[model samples]
Target: MRTLSGDLIAHRLSQAPAGALSKRLYDVLQTAIQQGAIATGSRLPASRDLAQELCVSRNTVLAAYEQLQSEGYLQTRTGSGTYVCEQLPETAPQASLSPSTSSAPFNHIRLSRRGTRVLARSGAGAYQWGAFMPGVPDVSHMPHDIWRKIQLRLSRRMPVEALSYSNHGGCLQLQQALAEYLRVSRSLNCAPEQILITAGTHQALDLVAKMLCDPGEGAWIEEPGYWGFRNVLAVNGVELLPTPVDDEGMLLPDLASFSQLQRPPVLICVTPSHQYPLGSVMSLQRRQQLLALAKSAGSWVIEDDYDGEFRFGESPVPALQGLSADAPVIYLGTFSKTLYPGLRLSYMVMPKPLAARMKMAHSELYRGGNGLAQLTLAEFIREGHYAAHVRRMRQLYSRRRAALVKVISDSLGPAFLSQQGNAGLHLILSLPERIDDVALAAELEQKGVLTRPLSAYYIQGTQRRGLLLGYACVEEQNMAETFAPVLHCLQRRLSPA
Candidate 1:
């Protein structure tokens, strides 16, 4: 074992640039021990002598010694001096275990089958906010002051129970508030007991999948649908059946096409009010047919009413869940698109029969707890601030959407536009089938314009080629300038090919 004398320690301390003397000494000593310069079980100098040699205060040396001791790097004897630990905390476990128990190298490590699928099918993006980024709301205008005040007030006197894992479905106040809000705004018929708070649509989807589906079960989703729904079900081992969508929303898949499946679909995921990306409302006829199909097949219909509040001119479409007194639909709604994405608050109104079980499972699995935020939102809704904010954003988004449409039409002919629904935060820009939309989106991203390619949403079918362009967070006045580069790029791409 090497003897770490006061002079040797002072010399090591001098090699580092001056900063906090105690921290510098700690680092130098740690490096020395880790590198075996001061070998295991070596005795360290007395704190006072080391301080005198290094010209640091005695307290500084004591602090460094104490920190190292606390971290298991060094230990002090009752009468003797500080000595290096015989074994480091980091290496002791490995030293005790056999070679067979060693962890595999990074390249040799393997992910579970489910984990691999989850990673492979992820749809998340690097940048969430900027020009034409889809599915994001204008968080700048959210009533932050009001929300902050409510949060602060609640946090000051938050119950000990509120901080614990929420096993009672969710905060009752928010559930009751959502029950009333959904009834009035979206024509959703639900009781507070039937509503379960979730992290977001994905969690709600995950809950529905785990509860209603078994591994390898069949699920029907809209072709060119929200990638989130597909990825969630895919990771859970559900076989995806991409059903086609027209101007009237999700169409029934031909029974012959599903010959491989042993039985009917376990879940039918639909963005019924305003179809995601496409922005088509499911026709009344289609909605009835879907309900009938789900009932006969014993399948659950997941109605994702995301952004249904943002309809431009029309009264927002009634949610499919309210069509009947006992509809077999699970109504999913999110604050992400309306209030803001970071809120991470969304809900699902389960069928009367499934509500109790789903809620219990949700609490067990997710251990939901955001009482302060939940109560704050409850207060926001109760005070009518939520409604007022939605109305204001609807008007703002309408103007922005119009500005985006005009610029795109003026630069590239009106033929480029598709699914110009008078609702939702985004509009689809159609490209020729032959054009590589993923490649086009990548080029636009390079030019600082963010967009999602329509083709990527498809599971396996006739894929649509387009870009989903969002204008909600973007201001109307800056719309033309922000999208100018995209128009220039499209002009060149469309000219020859």
Candidate 2:
């Protein structure tokens, strides 16, 4: 809060390399004003005081002040001191605000081809939490007290080493805990050394794409797949071949049909547990077929089991990575859906051979940290809290899902067909062929009922006209109230015009 003085300012200005006195003074004042060292509306020292302090002639200081005023870096008040201008002048150079350009504006700078594609396919919504907002877990039901107790205990007693950078993969405790958990729960065959912890599944996919596939390499993605996967692969310059999904999961083309591709895919990403948005569990036969195909083609399968722990009634489908001993499957899982998104913890179980390379790359690319959280989570899993919480959420989500389904049936009737999927946090409500899912979703969103358009998930081919309604975050008691707007929107839209 100390006020800047004439002597101090003049001394600092004197440090500049030898140059014209007036020009140097002008440049220093201009820089100070631009960088906010001289705050806007701040009264500068009088020209006489600054001149005396710097031992410069009064005329030299006056000339510098006048030049600054002309450049709009200062505002002069007759009988008062000059003040830093609140705003830059119209003619002022915009070098700091924009990239260097002689005749064009910043907007003229072209985006990379991948950037353009990503922008065109951008599906990120501003709103995240609301009725039917897809992929969001009910954080309200989280065991905050238990989690806080663990966090507090760890914070107070954690070793100094736990506060520093973690191993290239992750904290050994967390990795071991995750490996065991995956082994028992998801049937993933992984050791602690094979696991590479990531910020989230998005980062996990990015690493896989970067390490396994090169730019422009053929990569197969499910047609109606997770947009995050699509965008990440696209940004990495992967030539994405949109493989269609069927009732059992991603449909693998016969070897004969596969041979027609200009280049075979080096990697294939699948949401095998509960195929995202659509919620179809990949059948064991299809899982075997995919593993075999990937093996035959010498490709890698990225198995993303994002919400596999939330199955309502059916027995949990074990991850595809566990099917074969040497299956080239990179198993990916995240705590975002299981716990909370803000925790930002996910992991990938890499094949042992690739583990060392991925670890090196992961460390170089994303230096691992967040040891405290990882340790806390490791304890959470080891102590059985994570499984217990998943079990509780599974029941809660089931009731909420049932409530939503009932509301849709009672309000919209048979016109809207809800896909029967007992796993995952969301369900796809297929609409009548004539109704536009996007328009309906927009109307619903305006009315406070959030839903994702099914067509947006498709990269190409005939897109299904449906709405993905997530029920995990909505309580059973509020289901009717939350869905009321959806009913009204549908009634207005589906009514004869």
Clash number by candidate, in order: 0, 0
Candidate 1, residue 277: Cα displacement in angstroms equals 1.8
Model 2 worst lDDT window (10 residues):
94-103
* Candidate 2 lDDT tens digits, 14-112: 665567888777766766666566788889888887887778899988998898887778888888878888887766653222112133645767888
List the pairs of residues colliding in candidate 2: none
- The lDDT for every candidate, in the order shown, is 0.85, 0.84
Candidate 2 RMSD to the correct structure: 6.4
* Model 1 vs. true fold: TM: 0.80
TM-score of each: 0.80, 0.80
Name the best candidate (by lDDT).
Answer: 1
